[model samples]
Every structure is written in structure tokens, then in C-alpha cells.
Target: MKRIAPAAERNKDPILEVLRPLLRDGATVLEIASGSGQHVIHFASVLPAVTFQPTDVDADARRSIEAYRAETGAKNILPSLALDAASDTWPVHSADAVVCINMIHISPWSCCEGLFRGAARILPAGGALFLYGPYRFFGVFTAPSNEAFDASLKAQNPAWGVRDTDQLLALAAETGFAHEETVPMPANNHCLVFRRL
Candidate 1:
């Protein structure tokens, strides 16, 4: 059976609303960790001018993304590629924008650090790097659900937990990407946008 991430269904449109204005026309958008490929097909179908490049390190996930691309007949969506956000050498070195959804909390913290370095390397001046997921702002915002989510992530992997936005900003700044904006999303989440400085 095919898998589904409920959050994808929930947030894709809201994200698209915010992304519509932020994304430049005819720009190339690289989506890291394109888990089920649902968002790529939907985004590509909706935003025809912006090219969507979906990527992930997992072979199975890549196949899933490819399958969706073929099934949906999305011409604007590029072929899926193997891209581990923790790597310094991405297959494609240049993109107008890079996006990652729901990855930072599930993967090791090093993945976020690598994402900053990679975004810094690939994005041009004024290019955007977007991240969508739950975040704790400076160790504040003590919602019970968020606390439970954090505990669950830690239980699964010692290295995994929802990130703190201030810490993330520091890392992004270190990698030459400055914090630009933050958009609140449904279900205890946020869309953090940064730009290459």
C-alpha cells in the first residue's frame, strides 16, 4: 500500500499560498526530502512557471516520487534525485530556491546544519531557502502536544527533536544565510524563510 503523510495534505495549500508570492517566476525550486512526492506533483501542477526538483536520499522515497511524477504527468516537476541534506556536494549546485518540509525534526540535527551549508553554496544572492515544520522558539512555547512530539522524536532517535528557531538562525547566519521571515502554519507548525546574504 502507498503511504500518506497527513500533514502533507493539511499544509500543502497553505504553504502554496505563502510560497506563491515568495517564489520568483520561472525559478527552480529544489524540494529536499520529497517523502511521498505528493507535494511535488501538487505544487508542480499548481505553480506551472516554477520548476520543481524533488529529491531524497532514500531509494524507496525516490521511486515513490518518480511514480507520482509519472502518474500525475507533471511536466514541470523534474526527475527525482538522490540528495542527502547532510552532504556538502549536492548533485545540483545552483537553484533559485531550496525548500525542505518536515525533515529537521525527524532527522539528526546535523542535517539542518548541512542544509544551511548546502543552501549557502547553491543559492544565489537574494535566493530563498524555506523550511516548513514545527519549531520551538528559543525553548519557549510549551504546548502539550509539542512537548509530546519532542519526546516522541527523542525516543525514536537521540539526535532527533523539534529544533529551536534561534539556534537555527545562528546556524543559518554562520552559513551566510540570514533569517528573513517566519510564517505560522496550522497544527503547531511554521514556515521559516531565509535568504543567502
Candidate 2:
């Protein structure tokens, strides 16, 4: 069986552009909500020195990750693990960096809170948490498409909508992460990088 992440095709290169400079040689990165495992396998293929440990809560996704890893023969891509963003217990305790893409808006806001809390506990001082997704800023939507997307997401789940960058920063602050940089990407999405303070 085969699987794929819909956004991986469009966003991986852009995400990598931001990640390449930030990623240190031989650093361990824990990828959250690794749907289809496409990102992990693609990234690991390019960055053999950097170890990528992919995690997803879904069993089917885990199987897809394994399938991709096996097909790619990428050693730097570690076996996928089950990780629930809202759960107190995570599969791994520490990582040099954490990457999550397109998760916050699809799930309840508490998941973001939990993600930051877990990052606080696991990230060493100066370690980074990189989040990629569409977001609002200053109570304003960045794009009309984003506004429509937010409306659709809310229709699906009231608690799920594009988060405000300021709100997210505040939440990260509560979890001991200081804002580092905000990069603009294609499709009105933003890449927020925060360092453990």
C-alpha cells in the first residue's frame, strides 16, 4: 500500500529552504504529525547528516511512514513513532529541533498548547521549534483564501481555525519559548521559529 501527504508536494521545498540554514549538522529533529511520512523521507534523503524521527498518532500513517522509509532506504530517517500532540507523554524526551506542519489549524487549539508545553520540556536551551501553517496576525487575516479556509475549518470543527501569530507567540512564551523569526511562505502560510528561552 502507498500513501501521500497532499501538502508535502507543494510545501517541502519551501520548508526546506527555511530549514537548511537553521538545521545543524548531525542534529536530531523530531517531526510531529508526520502524515504519509513523505516529508521525513524526502528530507532525510537530502540531509543524511541530520537524523529525522517522524511521529504521527495515526496507525495508518505509521505504516505509510514505514513503507516510505523501506522504499527509500534512507538510514537517517528513523522509524516513525506514535505521538499525540495533546498527550502528556511523548515518544521521545529531547531533540535538537522539532518540526510541525499544517497541524495547528486542523486540530483544536489545545493541541497547539500541548505542543508548546511538550517542546518546553524536551527542548534544550537554544533548541528550536519550527511551526509551518496558515495564521492570522493582529486579528486580521493575511489572505482571502486563508479567511475562507478558516471558515471552512471552523465549520468542520469550531475549535479548529487558523491561529493568530500573536496568540501563538503568547502561548509559546507561556511554555518558555521566545520568538526567533517569522518567515513568509507561499499560500499565505508562515513559518515561525522559536527558541527555548
Q: What CA RMSD would you report for each candidate?
A: 1.1, 0.9
TM-score of each: 0.97, 0.98
Candidate that scores best on lDDT = 2
Give per-residue lDDT, candidate 2, residue 9: 84
State in Å the error of residue 170, model 1.
0.2
Model 2 error, position 53 (Å) = 0.6
Q: For model 1, which pairs clash?
A: none
The lDDT of model 2 is 0.91
In the range 43-152, model 2's lDDT, one tens digit per residue, is 88888899999999889999999999889889898899999998889989999999999999999988899899988889899999999999999989999999999999
After the best TM-score superposition of candidate 2, give how far the Cα of residue 13 lies from its true spot, in angstroms.
0.5
lDDT (Cα, tens digit) per residue for candidate 1, span 1-197: 23477888888999888777878779999999999998888888888889999999999888888888878888899998999999988998799999999999999988999898998999999999999988999797547798899999999999999899999999988999888889988888899999898
Question: Which run of 10 residues does model 2 get worst, by summed lDDT?
Answer: 1-10
lDDT of 1 at 161: 95
Candidate 2 structure, TM-score to reference:
0.98
**Which candidate tops TM-score?**
2
